[model samples]
Target chain A: MKRKFFSDRDKLEPALITIFAGVFSVLVGVGLIFIVSKDPVQSVRNFLLGPLLRTYNFYYLLIAMVPITFTGLALCIIYQLKYTSLIVDSSFYSGAIVATAIGINVSLPPGLHPAIAMLAAGLVGGLISLLPAILKIKWRANELVSSLMFNYVFYFIGSFVILYYLRDRNQTILASMPFQKSFSLPKLVENTQLHAGFIIAAVFVVLVSIFLFRTRWGYEIRITGANPKFAAYAGIPVATVALYAHFVSGFIGGIGGAVEMSGLYRAFIWQMNPSYAWDGVIVAMLARKNPKFVPLSALFLAYLRVGADFMSRRGDVAFEFITLLQGLIILILASDKIANYFKERRLKRAALSHDLAAQASSAGGQP
Target chain B: MIKFIISVFSSSNYWFIVLRSTAPILLVTLGAVITEQAGIKNMALEGSMLWAALTGVIVSAATGNVWAGFIAGIAAAVVIALILGLFALKLDANAVLCGVALNLFSTGGTVFVLFSLTGDKGISSSLASKTLPFIKIPFVENIPWVGKIFSGQNIIVWISVLAVVVIHIMLNKARVGVRIRAVGENLEAAKSAGISPNRIKFLTLAVSGVLAGMAGCFLSMGYTSNFTSGISAGRGYVANAAQVVAGGTAVGAIFASLIFGLTDAMATYLQNIGLPPELIQALPYVVTILGFVVITLIRDRKELIRKKKLFEKDRAKPLASGLGA
Candidate 1:
């Protein structure tokens, strides 16, 4: 007989795994502290407890999270459609590059440039995102493989544009000309360097949550993802929904790129960002692809990233110690069977106590 | 033109350069082909290859043996591939997500390790490492076209060719080949038949790792003298395309690899001919895009024909029923 106390679908597993991942991540953070600094313990405390120790660092962490939060929410749209096998990350990168390209090129008024850049990023990202969607629906091509390949194509194109065409010869390194100062998002805080992008990101997340939970189109996407054949039988147009999902995913991903570029750097910087698209994927995964939860997840990740960077600077440890820890955590999460073991033990003990109480009550009544 | 042909054949230098460039990509694609045939989608080949290359270089630098580096490279790739296989096949995580994670992990882990190792932020040098050497066959130069293509090539080239034959035979003629094909076709049916789909997936993934590892070895130790931080630059995706274009045949994979090799060579030639570097650089991706378009067209056409046949079957079915009634 199956035990009622330890059902397979218990939420406790996820909770335990989350705690384990957090602790493991901090442990790695401490190790990095030792590697980089003479006093590893102090370094760990500074990193884990340091950001919280100062109101300034905490604000910086929030500022750092602005772009990722936007990107992460945008990613959750595609993740919801179960088309994650396709364009989530590609959309994110394409958005950033498109936004950067326009932000650097256009000589717009200062107040309008940020908005224009964000929209441009979204549109570009969205358009590129549709390539794989079109292929998948029209020709039955594999979305995952094609989207993955398109990223490289975009990389080469972006690099070529940045290096030969747009590169600022005045600068020591290869990068774009200083983006028009007009493109900078308005500064919000007095003492800190945080921009208005954080507020914008938060607002966008709420809007996405509403669209995902309340809209008719969103319902169709959910139904289609849950069961395409059933959705088809129910008269939902699977092809149209799938295409729409890809298009929207691409659009938001693009916006993420634009916001990130405008908010963080004065100009288009690297040939590519450190796979922010992939980080968006990580965020989406941690949120279990929920549009509402992505903001929180993105912030958590951003905190870890910001803390790790600070830790490395303050101590002797390399930045890769964090990556190894992240990988370990992700690997554990991927294995549901292994992750659930910790939670199962807790439930087993709880059930044993309940049985013992029932036996003692019956014995007392008989005496 | 005659001089060009003669120059190609006469110079071991030309053959060596071509062989070196092609070997890693070919082996990597062959590994992808193994998984593709087993109906497993693999985008982690790039990550596996990168990881293997990093491991191979580090091991060779420490051990002072090219062969030891080669083994270490293969081992590194296999371990990564095994993790992917376990996640994809056993745990039911999305294969594509696993591929993405592997790529991310490889990129970050390698950079972290590189920073830790040499305190360099970019390419690692060949200061203390042993690189694989090109082998020249004795008196084979006396033969015809076979001699030109086969002799004085990287050992990886020979291994890749042998791999093609081995994979072809194992996939087509062996009992296990039948099971692998069955698993690819329908997992549920394979499970009902007691063929164990997960087992086949694991096996194919292992094979993929070995091939990808060799490819990494060829890349770091065979083709290039040193390893760069961003090595295996999207070769894995191309390998997937090669597998798809080849229609899951090992021989077809070789032909596809040749096409890619020729395209890469064409890009180099274009660069040499003073084509804009931007245009020249775009060549590989442009070619891949074209490949995707052409392949999609072909697949659509085939699907159309199949639909027509089905329609004919339905129409004939009505006439037969009417006559019988």
Candidate 2:
């Protein structure tokens, strides 16, 4: 039940395993590029170090990192409760729709306009996400299954809203009218798309970290997640905590979506947008499910994404290869058996050394 | 609305479309049902289908043979299943997360390969991909409404029906089926009873792989003529919910699949009738959530009632003397 040695190794094991998984997967990814690309070394170089070589790519990486960090922070919160509610993806999209609706229609002061839009987005996102949580809590329905389907539902509904109400008849392509100037997120950099959304992301990253580690509600949520039945017996309201987790997560997701839509996009055009929620999933896993580490993970993922973009354009490799790498990283990190195997191996080694030392001492004393 | 409903339901073509639409969902549901019976939720059902669909399209196009594509497609899904088993069973990865990983991999991997082959990101219309043909039943084609509903459907449609029966027999009447159920119900007890859970699970996954592969191939080759990116859409995910609604039975999956099919077909039919297409599109998911909740409530209520009876019986027995002192 207790380890007599390797406590230090046990403490460092998770981080070690994570680094190993990342490096191992990247190597496999490089090998894949080798197999597929005409010039393997150049392709690998572009994939590995392309984002850092240029300022434009660096800014793009930061811009890409913004929304994912928000969603990753949300993921860190919801996943703490250990319930598989994938409503973050839906809520993130809904959040953008809400932001667009408010920004285009509701007139407000310059600052207040974007604020109100973000608040509305968060509210709508939270409400959309609550459906699955409520179903799971009240009826014992599988939240994961319900939420997966709900993503498609919300997406179609949001598109309906966009198509009917917000469509720009002047546009040749399917897209919404641009938001009012007041709704635009304040730009922070001269030649880059960097905006106040990045600052907001930073703020939430710290806030979530504090909320999780310091607050009583956070403690309750953590305990509930760790062992719901035990937490219930110990007087925590497990269901309530779980519900709170979903709402908070959805709020973050919604806000993130709104920020991304307003800051980076020229208009409410969704055709080019990849699901930031999935990117957030990769970020969350890369962060080892820590809110404080979300920024780091987001940056790492952003770098990979930007690198892949460069490689695809310049080195004849597909960007989709990075997605395969991301999936590999998640699987390797989430492999409980693999992690446990390492831990077991270490413990066994420790036990054997302990036995050896004992036998040698006993022989020396007898002699 | 009532008239519209009745008119839609009254048509033999409506039933035919229902069965046809249900075929893919039912195939995936059967895939889900088998895995769920073995206490594994193959979240990779979506990924498996994607890989299969893409493989079927590309291979058939390359070989100019639909059957070759079909076999290769199924084989690809089986490989995914084996990979899932390797990570989930051998390495003790969280099966759900592993499934998610595979789904992600499949989505990206399929696109990567597709882009590599044809330099197209979305559709395979340029390729000479062959589709499975619909057969005309000579004798059954003579029947009136029944013929219209049941006869001359696509080959995969018949395979789906045949699959239902084969899977039903395999799960209910076969030894492996019993072993799988035992493993699902009580892994520890099954192991203690000398059953190898790993072996049973591997077999279950292979079967699931074949079913999901068929569903995937059906979407690309049988239902549609060409491979489109995300052709499976959310059917793979829907099958999971349907399998749950069916209570993990092959027979129950038919009715569960039909329910979704009815809603889905209604979505297609109801689009022109004053309702927004998006609303119609959203209807199936809303129905699924409702069905999921209602079934859970029913099951929970039944459990509560059964527990109350046991409690009452226990209360009727003589109480032991106080032992607190």
Candidate 3:
């Protein structure tokens, strides 16, 4: 079969769509806020432009971005390996549990505290990620189902551990014990919420980019993902790479979990944390699973979340509108086939119009 | 002997509780089976249940009738399922991702509506949440062995049992059921035989929604008599797990559901006994993990045995082929 026109721009189209979709999402979000609140104009202004002005909120925004950065990085790692069905969401939760367990249990000195906690967290997350890999290799169980199911296991275990053993009795609210200074992330800008975790996240982003694009392992991962049979034929251990991809993905997700816990919260606040896993999945998708774009995507999501918080608090709109907007984006992104169909139609129309104009100009010259 | 007897009788309550708790999960399992068999992995069971719970509460409160709530819940769930079906089948959105989207939407939409209608954050109609009446068997109480199983259960439990039998019969005996299975097992084959895969998928999802809706009714109107933000609480996923374990068999689904229910009941029972509530609550999930492992192991073992049989059969076949030559 002959290839159709605009087939070459198929890859480029999604990037354009993503950029436009982001702006469209923001606009729709603003419209929803306006519907609920009296001053639609002011609500949009407050949401879009307000958070950047306040130094404290701005720092909080970056702090929020920290976990997202790690999750996006983790997702990118998995994506670069060519693994689909994006299973890192639950891995992040499992990772957080590991970090929290350490934070609540171990008493380390300040300088090494956060580092050790993060390392412990990554280990747990990576181990959890291995479940799906093992299942896929041994029993031909789908990784997506396995990882999704194991998320509940992680939640149950984490909640059990936190609520039973590590729970802070002094505080009436349900949460874990506060971490020792040794396990906590170091504060960088004295009074600001921005912690050293942000620096670490940035460093990891760069490392992930390098690992994905410049390394032999990365090439192996891509080769396996593209064609497992071909990769196997070429002597690549497809199963091992699949397992390792998840491990690295889970490791980063776990670190992100720990970073969020130590950098921001004093303790494990609830049985569940913010859906950093979902956010990470979305961030990864938005970046087309590109390692280089994870940092930016993570920051964008964090900004949206922080901005939503700021808007709902200051304006009359409910923060639930943020979820509605997120849903719209997901629906659109998942409908990539639909998006491409429209792009094809538009290109065909453009070509026809160009042909008609040329014929009209040629006839006029002959006359 | 005394400890064994005490454990048996005491754990007998555990058995009854397991039966009771399995009701929602069984409904969800049945729903998931139909959808999965139709080649549509309906991840929106949780969302459907949540919305159904909300609608059940709303209709029951409005009409003061539990049946009305039940019907309304099914209708509401179907609406949500249709919306999801539209996006998935017609728009060609990824089914699993769409499921995830719908689940998110359910949480947000329910909470948003809850705030608008009741000014409550997570729950609604505290004064209006009413439990369905439990039916006591009139004559079956006299039976010796069957008496314990027949007496004092809600109408929905009876419906759940009936549903299993009906679904089994339909799946195995009926032409519609055959078509549905064919659609799922091999879409192209079904299409070649004049069955529209898309229509089959949509109808299966709709039926799944109704089943899930009944489960939701069992949750809010049947027992809890309240609507929470996420009252389904991962039961949908549990049902998905159960469906897999059952290999889409209705009888297997019921048994799997009962097992999960027992896990849940044990967790709750342990909590009631002054064990750490969180640890007790984790029991079902731990069991779920174990269940996945066990199911996979059993499958692998069965496959190995089948391969061995095939090898033996092949040896005999080679001699037969040589004799023919």
Candidate 4:
């Protein structure tokens, strides 16, 4: 009954594109190593296998996956809603800032402290993200451009908050005061920054999936995204759905930033943009906008980050080379023509096999 | 606050700084405008500028010739745009995604190449890089007030102004411009008229590339003495917002760019008042977003009024549902 895997092209197309992009990126990665490395063979091996080579490297890779999983899941929702609002970075960073402020000033019990901080972070992230959507719905402004401008607005605002009010005179670098001891999320492993944040991120992955696939709100969101006018006609409040979609996206992203900060950082140390915004987009694209697959994609992207780091240290290539690979993958994955070509090739092969089977049946005359 | 603002505006140096800052941003704005008009969202402008800036400095340093570096920079940006064109036009890649990918590539590629070459990812200080000269207007320099504001600007600044005139004429008068507009306006219609949409888009992207190249070279070769990593510093992105505010015209780009220039100038002057430096940095972007919203609101109102007028004129006929649009 279910013999054909690509019975729906939509279902199989993303998978095919993902595989193609992965292969292309690997080839490019190897080519880069060949150009850069003195010992190409060793470097190639390290580049491919560096993240899993040792416990230390593997642990860091998991550590890197924590925040991106949050951002990635966040993006999957916004993208599902057909909004190109790139408010992830702002929300993430603002979430961190909000968490930092609370951790420093507010006093609470151990378990409740981090929870309150995260909730506040989510609120701030949601608020920051809601601006562009409001602008789009009310004034018919371009969400993409307006959201981009907001990234800058919030970045400098984050900087001002850190530099002026939260800055620690005792610290040499530009960083906020140390968060309360109770506010710190417990680390899972000794001698590593890998903390309970990963657990939270994992739980969020499930929660978001449930919210997306099981709930009534999720159904409304999907229907609205499928066709806005129809959804409106169906008595769904399209504008409200879009607003909350954006808000939830920002909320999740904000929690991610908070987790990273509360888990690893004792103070707000991000003077520059940590840039999970773009990376989240990359992860979501790789996962094909599925919340269930976000963790895997985030892990994969994290592996690349750690691999590049390990390769840089051990294989004698710069860590920044991974950025090029990311670019190449995005280029290929985003190309509809490349995806269509693969589909056409598959169809042609199927047709050829069908004809051969028919000829064999005719020759045998067994019917 | 009022007196401080007045005093700041009274200084000729303020206007001079405003114009100086406007030069590179204006070029980038112009680049965004042309591509936007050709039905292409050239998000790759930032990448083009970065590559051009990096390559221009590196090649010039290697070749021991400034002109070679300048030309090389333009070539680098053009090649990048063409690559985007090939993928987007031929392979049917999303233009915005392609641009974003290329920007990512440029970020890593430039640094990777830089570290490989000079063993420094931050700045290419080891190489004997040359800077483009400033041009002092002969008669204008002798004037009392106007001289200080207009004269002694970077050569790129003058070229940027001249480019304003050139782009205005090209977009309004040239046959190619008409084709570009037609293709942008309606792709099928253009194809029906025997104009290849791909060709026009490709050519427009190339011109934007050229503009980005000039802007890039200005940052490294003319604005500063050396190629500092991230010298472009999101000017290419801000240019997109400027393009929106500019209303897709060459002349409009100037006023939009000047608004940004003014904000940047005010930020610089406000430093003495002990304003939070980070807030100062954000002021221009905040203004841009505000400007973007205001313009959109104004346009929406105007369109609504026009639709109402159309409905009234056709009172006997059934009112089109598009009136609410």
Candidate 5:
């Protein structure tokens, strides 16, 4: 019963591998800066320290983490359903449009308008996301492709709504009319643009963590994700679980879009996909699809992004250096061989000890 | 609307545009078919096309030769495919994750390199890039409508058409094609027969890279003369949809790509009308989703019929034997 340091079933092994992958990728990022920048040392210094040099930049980093936290949580919920649904992107757009329309049209009181808009946005997003899930359940269509194609459809519809229906005639740029002032998320930190969305994101992290781990429905979802056949055998309605998971995932993404727009901008201004949904995939992976870790992972990505922005401003290094680093990290982290090598070694040793103990015990019994 | 449709279809120029636009999607879809046949989901097609487009523009600009650009573009895409294979096959990484990473890398990395080379994040207009020349068939030019439909298209268009035939023959008849299909259908059987599945997958991805690279070159050198950020747009995904709708066959993919190409042409044509640009731009994607739904429904129905027939056979066997006795 002696515990080994590097056993196959050791809980720390994945964390160790992820940490090593992170360090390795950071080194790769620095090496890339060396190759690309004229002053590699200055660029590296700026990338590492620039985000913390100013309070505003630090706040900007926090602000950036808000949207990704929502997306990361959204991805965590849907990915557990065993579907690689890209409909989160469409849901984000649909939610933003719905929220914008409500914010502009509704005449609710100051305290109620933004809340109502966000709830409506979540509903729209959930409905939009349900299309692909239904398609998968009913017709056996590939969810990934359908969802991807749906993103473009929803994107255009959202754009058309903004351009044709909600256009502010006074402005030349293609944007919807500004939301009523009362509809915007209140500033949490004055003069730094940090808003209540951060608070909501944090709350979401806790709520999603509880939902995924604490409830009977959550247990059913986990079982369904781990094995659909087993869940079916266990009398869990697998289809219903999938539908609910998709809705919750899309609901989170929708709220993210609404909160992001309300927090940062006054109007509906996005003409293209903001790619937060794509970044969500990376965040979820970095967090290993754990809602509890989404905040940390989102912060890590946001910090890298803010640092990249600062480096681009101060040095010759392009902001894309972070993307390259992210790609390398994901490639390394998702590689099973890296983790499997240690796992197989530990398992082999355990098997050998098991065989030796069995043989010795049998010999002693015979004597 | 009817008049607009009639006017668009009656014009020979619309057909020419459809033919021209179909080339890239056809090439990419054929590449997708090859990789999918080898049981590798080719999600990195977009990244491959984007990287190839960048390399095509840069090398063509540097060398002032279009053929050199095409070769370099293919080489760059092959390198990407090799890396993808290294991760997905050798290291046992999730293919989808590797694909998403490659796509994000291509989007950012292309702009990063573009900025480094020309200090422009948007377009490579500063580079004096050479485009592939159009080829006019001498005898075909004499035919009235046929000539207009066939003559004076980009050379890549003809290559893509010829590729469909070559791929069809290769997939159905060639030794490598048989091995790829075997590996795709049953990895255990192929492995038990001493065939290396990983090697076959690597080769399949490499071949896919070549075709995707060619498609990328077509975008830069035939469709446009300079590289732009996101030049591949969603054509890579559309090609993938085409492959899926075609059931991963070369001929079917080509025809499906043509339908998408027609939608593209229609979108362009519709832009001149009073319709909003957003709706026009969404036509191809909407059509692709509809195509997928229809195809899935047909496949499901066929499967149900097959199951019913099997059940009927099982039920009839005992009764038929009893009657015979």
Candidate 6:
């Protein structure tokens, strides 16, 4: 009998690799700060401990996680369908515009107004996402290129709407009129500035988890993604499933945009794409496109963002340092050779053990 | 509308604007063609261009030499391309994801460095950067109508045109080009013939980086006087569309870039005619998407026809064999 160096049945190798990558990136970030900062020790201290110093900073971290969790879940749904749809950015912007428009113009009862506004946002996002899906299905156009280009189109359109139609005449800046106070999301905690959007995000995470694992449509989507030809041969409508996946993902992204803006700001004040969509991509990748892990991943990213913001305020380090760290971690975790090496070795060992067991069993039966 | 069209066609300035806009796209598209020919999808063109633009501005301002700026810009882009290649080839990472991450990193990193160096996050106007020189061809300048179209352009414009011809000849007649195509078409076959696919891919990407660097130099030093954040804009993406529409051919990429440039110029022209500025700004992207759809449709039709012909040949083969027997 041979002693094994490691257990072949361990399923946490990829997760461990990702953790290592994260730690390595943090070290690199620390080194960067050392090179750039005059007071390197203080800078590191602020970067690591600044977010934990005050209750307000912790609340800010929670607020930051609200939109990221939604975006992360959205990306997870789209990735499960096996398409890299970059349309989420456009969907998010369009959702913000729709929500703002509805919130300002459509007068309704208190609770119903926000609900209708969010629904409108989701619909607009879904419509915007559908274009790229149709193009991909009908003409085999590359989704990544088309979606990225569409983001510019939507940006200009959103700006046009804000500057031309919905401009608050008294305000100097180009922005939509402020939504009614009755429409603002209710505060979740009494003292702190937490909003209902965080709760909505958590609910969405659970819903998405159930949607991906328990539903028949989810099963069909998984099958289509895993093997499109086999799904088609089995009478599954692969194209429709892919399209539905895009629509659902975009809808969630729209909800994210609506909740984020309504909960955080008084008016639609963004002049450009706020880039939550890109951040969502990073979160989804970190979670490995698992809906169940989206909350943890989103919280991790939001913590870094808040920590970086605090560091920038207190020290010489810029907030873009977090972006650099994100890029490094993504590259490292996405590297197949880095993350899959241990898993591949374990798989080989398992195969060898199975072979040995089979030979011994066959010899005994023959005797 | 007719008068506007006639004026646009008659004005040599319009043509010059078109040509100027076309230079960056053409150079970038040529790089894309080379990389695609070597079977490597180099989607980090945008990041490479952005970094190159920053380096070009900083180096020229620091050294007070335009040529040194160009060299530094190209060197920066080449280094980025090599890093991308190391990830895509050696580490087996998804090229698209890496490219996206690189773009984000470049955007953030450049601004971070800019702030560190000059305490400004928006533009490099504080730096005394010199622009690339414009050349007025002595003999060509004397001509009446053609001179207006060709003379007094940036030196990079002439180089871009020369690059097109050089790339065309290289792809069609050079041994390295043949080897790259072989590796692109069949990796195992090329490996059996004693060619290393990874080396070819790495070299192709390096060349691609140099071209992207030239485009960046044109943007900062030729098109504008100073480097601004987001200077590359969506030109790198437009170049990708042009390269795809060109079917990875040098001459076709030149023509495709011209079409995109024409649309871009038209958008600017429309801005002068009281059109909504936002819609006008979006024209290039709209045209690119429309052009992509048309190209995809045409290719699909051609593929269908080819398949039908093959089917017919298969049906006729047994009958011909029976007659021979």
* Candidate closest to the true structure, highest DockQ: 2
Q: Which portions of model 6 miss their true places by more than 4 Å?
A: A1-10, A345-367, B319-325
Predicted model 5 interface RMSD: 1.6
Model 5 spans with C-alpha error above 4 angstroms: A1-9, A352-367, B319-325
Give the per-residue Cα lDDT of candidate 4 at A47.
75
lDDT of 2 by residue, B85-178 (tens): 9999998887888888888888888878877777777888888998888888988888998899888789988899889999999999998888
lDDT, candidate 1, residue A236? 98
Report residue A265 deviation for candidate 3 (angstroms). Answer: 3.1
Please write out the lDDT profile of model 4 over residues A1-367, one tens digit for every residue. Answer: 4547568776677786797788779888889889877899998887778899888888899999998899999988987887777888899999999999999999999979999999999999998989989999999776877788889889999888888889999989888999999999998988887899999999999999999889988778888878999999999999999999989999999999889988989888886987888888888889877899999889889988888888888756878888878888888877788868867677777867776787664454321
Q: How accurate is candidate 1 locally (lDDT)?
A: 0.75
RMSD of 2: 4.0
Q: List lDDT for all candidates, in order.
A: 0.75, 0.86, 0.77, 0.87, 0.86, 0.84
TM-score of 1: 0.87
> Would you estimate the TM-scores of all the predictions?
0.87, 0.95, 0.88, 0.94, 0.95, 0.94
Summarize candidate 6's per-residue lDDT along B1-325 as a digit string, tens digits. Answer: 9999889878888888999999998999998899889898787888889889999999999999999999999999888788889999998988777777777778878877776677677899999888999989998888887898899899889989998998888888899889889989999999999999999999988988999999998899989988888899877777777777878789988888888889888888888988889988888888888887888889899988987777777778875333121
Q: Output DockQ, candidate 5.
A: 0.64
> What tier of docking accuracy does candidate 5 attain?
medium
Cα error of candidate 5 at position B315, Å: 1.7
**How well is each residue in B187-295 modelled by candidate 4, as lDDT tens digits?**
9999999999999999999999999999998888888877777677878878888988888899999998998899998999898798878899899999888887887
Native-referenced DockQ of model 3? 0.42
Q: What share of the true interface contacts does each candidate keep?
A: 0.35, 0.75, 0.43, 0.83, 0.68, 0.57
**Candidate 4 — which residues are off by over 4 angstroms?**
A1-13, A314-316, A346-367, B316-325
Listing candidates in order, what is each one's chain A TM-score?
0.83, 0.92, 0.86, 0.90, 0.92, 0.91
lDDT of 2 by residue, A1-367 (tens): 2354345676468767877887887888888888878899999888888999988888888888898998898888877888777789988999999999887887888888888888989988888878899999998888888998898888889889988999898999888998888888888899788888999899999999988889998888788888999999999988888888889899989998899877876578895335778778778877877887898889888888898998999967778988888889888987886676668887778777777778664444321
- Per-structure clash totals for the candidates: 11, 0, 5, 0, 0, 0
Full ranking by lDDT: 4, 5, 2, 6, 3, 1
Return the lDDT, model 4, position A283.
89
Best by lDDT: 4
Q: Across residues A1-367, which tens digit of lDDT does each residue of candidate 6 receive?
A: 1234244334467778867877888899889889888788998888877778888999999999988888888888887888877898888888888888888887888778778888889888887888888888999887877888888888998888888888899988777899988678888988777999899899999998888889988888888888999999999999999988888889988988888777887899886777788788878988988888888888888888898888888877778878878878778876888878887777778777776788664443321
Cα error, residue A244 of model 5, in Å, equals 0.9
